[model samples]
Target chain A: MQLVTPGIGLLFWMTITFSIVLFLLSKFAWKPILNSIKEREDSINGALSAAEDARKAMDALKSDNQKLLNEARAERDRMLKEASEMKDQIIAKATKDAKEVGDKLITSAKDAIEKEKLNAINELKTQVAVLSVDMAEKILRKKMEDRTQQEAFVNDNLKSITLN
Target chain B: MFSNKYKITKYLIPAFLVVLYVTYAGLKLANAQHEVHTDSTAIVTGTETGATTHSEVSHEESATEHKPEKVDAGKLIMEHIGDSYDWHIVTIGHTHVSIPLPLIIKDDKGLHVFLSNKFHHGHEAYEGYELKEGKLINLSGADFLDLSITKNVFAMFVAVIVLLIIMLSIAGSYKSNALKAPKGIQAFVEPLIIFIRDEVAKPSIGKQYNRFMPFLLTIFFFIFINNIFGLIPLFPGGANVTGNIAVTMVLAAFTFVITMINGNKNYWSHIFMPPGVPGWLLPLMIPIEIIGVLNKPIVLTIRLFANITAGHIIILGFFSLIFIFAEMNTGLGFGVSAFSVAFTTFMSFLELLVAFLQAYVFTLLSAIYFGSAVEEHHHEEHH
Candidate 1:
């Protein structure tokens, strides 16, 4: 009979004691503990998402760096190509100008030499005519001192001219 | 991995083993009973003559003769499972060592409080009150309230203090190191709390689990600790706190109160109107539904009380076998003790599993009831 029976005293004690325990625990223990767990979970999630954002930023930065490096390399290649082409054009233009100047000088010098040769030929012809006249005059004056000889010379010159 | 056939065999083998064990125990108990009957008759005859010659014999002689009296297995087991006014630790030779608890009672004279040792372990009365079969009775036969903190109640206090220490410390750690990982007792207890939350509360009580978490956790750990403590045969642990119907009744009552308080209109509607039921069956259905509501907590109370008490009884039963055999024949007692101790040890280990399992079941069921109470209903058209 005692085994199955319930005592009021224990029940009263249990109600009061358990209620106190539940109240104290809920206030001091459970609320704080549950809050901290939630806090830790939120913080962990925050950290994970932050790390993800950082990784994404790093990826973006890396891609931007790669794009910048490619652009720089392309710019360098374009500048180098342009500079080389300009250098070849400059050298070719300078060589063509130098050849034209040398041709002009040689042609002008030839024209001047031709003109001097013609002049010298003309001068020698005139000097030859003058010298021939003087020699003829001296020969005539010496011959004419003897009348007969002079006449003979003139008659001979005329006969020779008629024969020619 | 158990294939279909193997699974069948698995269950079948255990069932067969249980049948075999029960049959064997029945035979042994029957034989032991026959022997006990003869032995009790002899004791009764001997005591009758001894009582007649009591005038010449000293009181000490009578006490010594009554000391090693016949061992009644049922009484022994019941005593082990039942509550007591004192915490009985052990008995050696003719001496008994136990811790007396405070006795508080209420009567016409008002509330009276004193040490239970005043009764001298049921030997004599004190201040008009005498201990009778573990209850304090007034000699005047007046109605009184036995509100004394008995063995079970004292054990509960011990359990409460232990729970406070463990939980407060864990709570303190959460406060001090809010961001750090759980360690020590926190680590050990956190998983169990999480299990009750995720496995028991969340799934059963759904989104409103937070409202019931404190109560659920309190009862879970409280019952679990008491159950484990009940298994230990030592001073701090021997009190059958959880096995007591009064404790389980209070626990089940709490669940009942919370359930009824939290029960929504839908819950009541389902009980009274009961959707899809024929109109003619209203009266029958309503009473049954009300009974159903009351039955849930009643079942909860009895289930926990019986399971724990039964486990204690089985183990004690095994222990009594040796004593029963020894009273029949000394050599036979020695031989039976080997088997008795083995079975008792095995049962104790099984009880360890049952302790945790019963706690889980109780919490789970309470959460389920809470879930049902607050569950939402949806109307659907059926063609």
Candidate 2:
């Protein structure tokens, strides 16, 4: 093994130089680096804030959608209730109109029947009267055929009137 | 004039040397434009043995000179440290150990290697290996400044440059498009950057994360490079710099200093006289807190050093089985060597993940300490 050793001068110079170099590096190079790091942290904070806002927006939207859904269900229920009421009213009115029409038809038919019966009775009476007159005429004609009858008939009639 | 002199003393030669080191190392093998195999770091151990011809036995009573009996290749191979397979593997008989390239430094004159007679195996009495070729023998009398053109030094240089290029590229991408989707190398780098910035820096230092980014990044990148460089197979970029205690110590020291400097009044007060506590308990708590502060960096240092060193030693130990089993018999050698290749390959893959992990851990610790230092306990203010 070679027992060659480094002299003291090299060590002395190296130690001295290394110390100074470190000092210069500390002074000149450290500040810029730290600034950049701080900038990055600020950017990360911005991203986190943006994410939180998005979550709130989504929650609000979900509640609004629920509210709209509830309102739509209420409106549908109201419309069905109104339509049911309208159907009942329409049925009641129609039933009243049908009953009125039936009553009017019955009344008009009764009146017509009564008129027809009266007319028929009048016609029958006239006929009966005509026939009775005719029959009496006939009877008188038969009696007047005897010559003596004409004088007697005139006498009877004069006496009866004087007595009355 | 004296203040100005103090400023000069603080910066002048030191800055110049850093620039010089970077340039000198970069010029060696910097794939700045297209950094492919330019690992962050690598560790290559050398098995340089004293020649069998003249391993002279001399008893020169100096730290530099002691001699041993002529060691044959078989014994030398068994003891050989650095890049060999044995250092990566530890078995029942042998433990993994790395022989560092004799540390070298360069100047106007040629290269040199330090002469140390300190027997690595023994603290007692022994001889040391000397260079065979006199002309090739580059020795500086100073213990540390052995300027030799060794494989490990060149690797260290190359690895550092490779790391710089990768980091610079990542920095550029960040500057150009911080917000856009990362593609190419940007994809690989951006996650690490953000993790460090958001998880490590911001939470730790509160309002002061911006002030500590560069220091954190440099340490992370430096550790990463050295760790990656240590894993490569070849010599030029294969020295485990992070595994070395000396290297880890310097990094930990930086963390300690930064924490101390940046700590506000609240931090110091909390450590010394914790709020709402009994007056009598202050004495016990204060010393413990001080020790605790010191211990943080020590842990950081040891963690990196131990992890990096262990990976290399494990790889070496597995590799040494080939030689050990080879001595057993031909059939055993072939069978053991075959299995070893498979095992080593599996481990090497794990090392890639580990390289990045170690870097991450070091950076994380530093950031945490910085965080505590600048932490303003709001309750204390209310009191």
Candidate 3:
């Protein structure tokens, strides 16, 4: 069992054997291993491609979202503008309508006041005329009550009439 | 241009071989002194105070006269030359350079240029001695040739060639879809190739990793294949190429060089004057950063060298237990040797994992180093 100084003969043969084995292994074993590596590479490329597509999609989605947001903002702005404009128009229309109605009421009121005043003046004149007539009658009756003055005034008036 | 690149790559294995030769020679030389490893006559009996000494003398020792080596390049190269080495020192000596043809055994040191007057009828042998310097010792340059081509080297070579053939062949298959239904080796190796490209190179080095892919792939395969090759006990596996420190050092050096060359202004700035650091602290930070630059490769070298070396040593040590116990007593030897084999085999099984794990760790670290060097450590680029 003493450890043999590994013989030169042993060394020579071992070299040959391993060389053949390595050569053979290189021929057969390495090819498949490389294929597997290439396969791994292909898979990696595929993964990278997928990742690229995903990133692009994400970017597209983000821009689209921004566009939509901008559109929403614009629509909101337009609506606000329209509401303000409509409010102004409505206010202007209401004010004009109120002025027109006020003018009609004032004209009607002025006519009514003038008609009442004319009626009042006519009625006063009638009353004054009637009172004057009544007063005259009363004065005549009073003069008649004074028979002598009344006869003389009557005779004077008849004489003045005969002469005309 | 291709050839230059190939030339660079050719050195990687040669570098491994060179280290193997050196380690083997060092082991042999240490064996004479009885103390490179743990299983030698110098070690004592028990696992006590002096028990470890006997274990140290188990390595092979060559007969020597202890001469200080002359520092000649030729001599340095000659020392570590492997069994296969046979340099013609003298051509016109009439009988193979005055030295006997096939003069000595692989392990025995023999002179390449034998002088007619020196030995038996125009034959002489090589000489060797330890090269020494002030506080340092190296073998003369002559002995530095591939002295011991261990099994690890063979296995590593085969692993490399095999890896090449497999890769080239599979690459053909991939390009052509050759196998209608490929199985076995193709299946295993192809994935790794792809993994190296997509996983290792791309993420760290970026999409421009194509140019760098081949190197990374080569390194991964080289380390992985050798590690596995080391595991096999019969032939190629025993070389322990990864275990050698010199080999790992060179590998780390390659990384360091590549990283430096590829590094941008950003990388260099971090080393010389780190960014975001206060002006007052720049003096301190700069030195530390400079030190860190050197530390990276050193850490890399030690991590690999130690891990691989540890595995080999442990396995060998386990096997040695049988001899140690048997040497102590006949009964103990019988029982312990049997136990040691089984234990060693189990350890070898575990070593396979370590082999791969270490290779992975080394590769990962190398990749990290590359990444750091190329990384843009400035804020201006962010905008």
Candidate 4:
């Protein structure tokens, strides 16, 4: 019977003790404990979202760098092509100028050689006429040592001239 | 994992053998006790029905003759589980060593306060109140209120103090390390708090669980701590605080009051009108609902009280077996004691599990009741 009985004294004490426990714990213990838990959860979420944003920003920056590199490469390729074209054009112009100068030199040298050849031919003709006259004079003086032979020679030449 | 299972079975085989051995020994002892118990029951029944004429004459005469040898197992079990004014520690020969507690009573004459030790172990009367069969009886047949610090109440004070210290420290740690990873006792206690929150409070009571968390946690740790302390079997441990019917009644009352106070309009309507039921059935349903409402808290009270008390009785019963057999013969007593001690140890372990389990069950059921009380009706009929 005692085992099943509910003692009034115990019930009274239990009510008082349990009420105090509930009141104190609710004010001091549960309030701080639960608040800290919620705060920790919020911080964790903030850190995760921040990490996600950083990763996205890195991806965007990586794409931007790739675009800049591609543009630089294209510019380099155009500059290289223009430099090669200019080199080819300069080489062709130099070669053509050199050929024209060589042709002018050859023509001028050919003209000087023709003028010298004509001058030399005129001089040679004049010298050959002077020598023929001196030779004729010398042959006449030698024939006049005999006066009669000289007179007959002159008359024969005159007669041949009158007949012509 | 397979290796681990095999290892577990390796250890399990020996433990299983031990259990089998203990059970066999227990059955043998039971058979022996049963034989002696029949004769004793006849004498005990005779004493119980002294007013009746039939078998009392013969049995009463036999009971008086056999009183020296007979062991009262029922009395021993009751004394252990029942509340007392003094804390019994040990017994040596003819002397009982115990810690006397305070006794306060208010009678017709005036208030009387004294130490329980003045009773001289219930052999004498002190201050007009005689300690009779573990109860204080007024000498002049006057009505008085006993507000003594009985064993259960003292144990509750100890339990409350321990609860306060541990809980306050945990709260302090939370304040110092807010939003930081838990450390020390915080690490150990945090998970249990979260488990009650997620598994018990949230699922059972839903969103309004926050409002009830303080009360829920207080009762959970209060009962759990007291239950654990009750298992200690020493000073500060042996008081069956949670097993006391009065204590459990108060705890259940708290839940009942909370539920009634928090019950919403929908809760009341469902009990009074009971949606989806035919109008003719209203008469039967409403009374049933009212009975069901009252039954919930009563069930909670009995469930906790019975579990804790039953555990104490089983342990005490196994312990009482040695004395029961000893009263028969010395050698039989020695032989029975080995099995008695072994079974008592096993029961103690089982009680430890029961201690936590009962606390959890009480809290969970309370949360479920709260959930039902505050639940909203989203499917109301247009009519």
Candidate 5:
């Protein structure tokens, strides 16, 4: 019967002792313990999100690098195409200038040859006229042996011609 | 079936070994019991004379008349489970070894404080106050306060010291290794602490769990350690602290006080004028709700006390069967002891499980009560 009954003294002691323990533990122990746990959890979460942000930044940087590389390749291709076009233009201009200079030289050479042929024909005509004049003079001198004979022959021929 | 001779020996060898083991254990137990009986008889006789001489003038003369005979199972079990003025450890051949605690009493005359040994195991009276059936009473039939440190109190002090050491060390680890993971005792206890916090405290106490966490944690560990200690049945153990109604009542009272102190307007309103109930039902519902508040703590008190006490009783009952059978026949007693010991061992293991379970139940229920007290009644917004 006494076992089931509650004693006031025991109750008093229990209340005092339990209250003291609760007060002591709550102040000294529980505060630090719970705070540390929460702190750890917060740090873990921060680290995780920071890592995620870093990964996204890396991805964006990779894409930016890829875009730059593609632009550089396009620029190189355009420069190569322009350089080849300039090379063709320079070669064509050189060829056309050389053809014009060659054609002028040929025309000048033809004109010189035509002028020399005309001069040569003119000299040959002069020389042939001189020779024919000389030959006529000689034949006439031989036929009139003496001046008197020549006069008489002239008179005689004239007279004959008149009489005839 | 092939070889019957070989099969017979195979089963027979293990059976022979088991029989040998049982016999050895039974002999040891019988020897110990014999020693206890002889020792207890001598002490009883010596104390009987001392008590008669000192308390000859007292009214209760038959208080010290108990004698050692064949075992009285009921008396023995009661003595084991009940609180005492001193901590009895063992008896060895007429010598009873016990630790005497201080007995403090407040009466009309004044406060009287002395060692409990002066009463000599409730055999002799010390300064007109004698123990009558485990109660310290005055010979003059006057009322007084007994604030003595009994066996349960002493056990509680030991338990408190152990709790302080374990918890403080764990707290230190948490401080030093703040970012690192828990280790050692911290590793062991952190999970249980988290369990109470997450499962018990958070779910029941909701958002304001932090306020009540300290109280809940204290009660949970205190009850749990004491329960585990009571199951040990050795020195520093077997003090039925949680089994005592007074101890459980105090624990329950703490919960009751906290709940009432922390009770919000919603809590009181719900008790006095319950929402959603008809106006006419107020008269009946109000008192019932009020009783419901008081009943929660009372139930908490009785639940812990009864569960622990009942477990101790069942274990002791199994132990008593051996003596009861021994008195009938020597061989019968020996035969019964085998079963008795087996059953008692099984019960003790079961009690271990029950100890933790009861502690959990008590903490969970207390958390639920605090939850209700601080629960906010949010009005539903009609769509």
Candidate 6:
């Protein structure tokens, strides 16, 4: 019976103490503790999201750098190709001009050689005729008796000329 | 399967009979002891020597009550569990060493205040009042209000003060630290506070959990600290603060009152005219719903009180075994002491777990009630 029974004094005191504890703790202890905990939690969440935003921004910046590098590489390749094409054009033009100049020099040299050969040939023919006439006069003086041979040679030449 | 069933019943029948016989014997002993106490108090007026001589005559089995000083295990166990006017410490021979608490009373004469030690452990009467069966009574047949600080109340005050100091200091730390990382005791208690918020209050009370956090936290720590303190077998701890029916009654009443005050329109409607019920069954269903509403607090009170009281009883019973056997033979007493000590230690450790579990259950159930009371009628939108 005593085990199950509740004393009125204890009950009275319990209610008073419990109510006081609740009221005091709610006012002093729980309010401050819970508010600070909540504030800390919100701040923690804010920091985490801020870090996430920073990481995303960094990723965007890295990609932008990659795109710029790619564009610069493409520009460099295009410039190298243009330079090589211009060098090829300049080399082709020089080779064609050199060939034309060489051809003109060869033609002029051939014409000059032809003129010199013609002049030498005419002079040799006139000198050979004069030497032959001198040899024949010396032989005629030595041999007045050969006048008949000389007159026969001239008559053969005059006959050939009249026919022509 | 039939064979197996028969085999189980072969052992079960005898086990049930043994349990029945033991309970019958216990009840008879308790009845006999109860009569002995009343007879002594009535005739001899609550004296130590008078009660002993009277008990010896009543109980014939204890032929040598005077020489050996018979140990009444039942009485000892009862005394350990029951409320008292003073804080009992120990017993040496006929002398009881205890701390006397204050007694405040209001009678037809006037308000009287004095220390409970003036009664001398119920061995004598003081002034016009007398300590009868661990209770104070007015000898002149006058009614009075007993507003004294009993053993349980003193324990409660101690528990309350300790809770205040620890909690207020922790709250102060929170103010100083602000958003910085927790350290020392702050780090230790922060997780438990968070667990109550996140696991208990949040899930049990939902979005409005913040509105009830203060109440939830107060009750949770109050019950938990008292439960743990009740397990300590020393000064300021041994009193069953949470186990006391009066204390639990008060706690449960708080939950009940809070629920009633906060009950939304949907809650009241569900009680008066429950949804999904046929009009024909309205009369039957409403009464049942109302019963269910009142039943929640009763269940909370009984659950905490019974669990803590039963734990104390079992531990005390195991300890009593040693003395009960010692009355028979010294060697047997020594032999049983080993096992008794071992079992008591094991039960005490188990009680530690029960201590935390009961507190958690009380708080969780309270939060659930609060949650249901404030719950909105979201079912309408689902259709």
TM-score of 4: 0.73
lDDT tens string, model 1, A1-164? 77778778778878877888888788878888888887888999999999999999999999999999999999999999999999999999999998899899899989998889888888887887777778777876776889899789789889889863
**How do the candidates rank by TM-score, highest first?**
6, 4, 1, 5, 2, 3
State every prediction's TM-score relative to the real structure.
0.73, 0.57, 0.47, 0.73, 0.73, 0.81
Give the fraction of native contacts in model 4. Answer: 0.85
In order, candidate lDDTs are 0.83, 0.62, 0.58, 0.84, 0.83, 0.83
Q: Write the per-residue lDDT of candidate 4 for residues A1-164, one digit (tens) a residue.
A: 67778998888888988899999988988888878877888899998889999999998898888888988898999889999888888888888888888888888888888878777777777777777777777776777779788789888888889964
Q: In model 3, how well does chain A match by TM-score?
A: 0.63
Better of 2 and 4 by TM-score: 4
Q: Write the per-residue lDDT of candidate 2 for residues B75-187, one digit (tens) a residue.
A: 43323222221122222333424333343434445353442222232322212223332112223433223344233333445665665556555546656756545668757
The TM-score of candidate 2 is 0.57
Q: How is the predicted docking of candidate 2 categorized under the CAPRI scheme?
A: incorrect
- Model 4: number of backbone collisions: 0
In the order shown, the chain A TM-scores of the predictions are 0.61, 0.48, 0.63, 0.54, 0.52, 0.64
Q: Could you give the DockQ of candidate 2?
A: 0.09
Instruction: Give the runs in model 4 whose Cα sits over 4 Å from its true position.
Output: A63-164, B1-70, B329-331
Top-scoring candidate (TM-score):
6
- Tens digit per residue, CA lDDT, model 2, A1-164: 22123223323433554565455434443343344445555667777888888988998898899889988989889989999989999998999998899889888988988888888888888888888888878887888778779668877887787964
What would the per-residue lDDT of candidate 5 be over residues A1-164, giving only the tens digit for each residue?
A: 87889877778788888888888878877777777777877888888899999999999899989989988998999999989998898888888888888888888888888888888888888877787778777876887877988998799889878753
What is candidate 6's CAPRI-style docking category based on DockQ?
medium
DockQ of each: 0.46, 0.09, 0.01, 0.58, 0.45, 0.57
Q: State the interface C-alpha RMSD of candidate 2.
A: 4.8
Considering the two chains of model 3, state its CAPRI-style docking category.
incorrect
**Candidate 6 on A1-164: residue-level lDDT in tens?**
76667788888988889999999999999999889999999999999999999999999999888989988998899898888888888888888888788778777777777777777777777777777778877786665567787688788778888964
Model 5, position B94: C-alpha lDDT score: 61
In angstroms, the error of model 1 at B33 is 27
Question: For residues B1-383, could you state the per-residue lDDT of candidate 3 as single tens digits?
Answer: 99985885587557645644654454344344444344434544443323333322221111122212322433322221211112233435235442122322132354333222333331332343221210011235342222233323444556667666776676566545542444667678766666667667778776455445544555677777776776665533455566555556556776788788888898887777666777899889988888888898889878876676667667666666655554433344455555566567768878878877787777777777788888765466433
**DockQ-better candidate, 5 vs 6:** 6
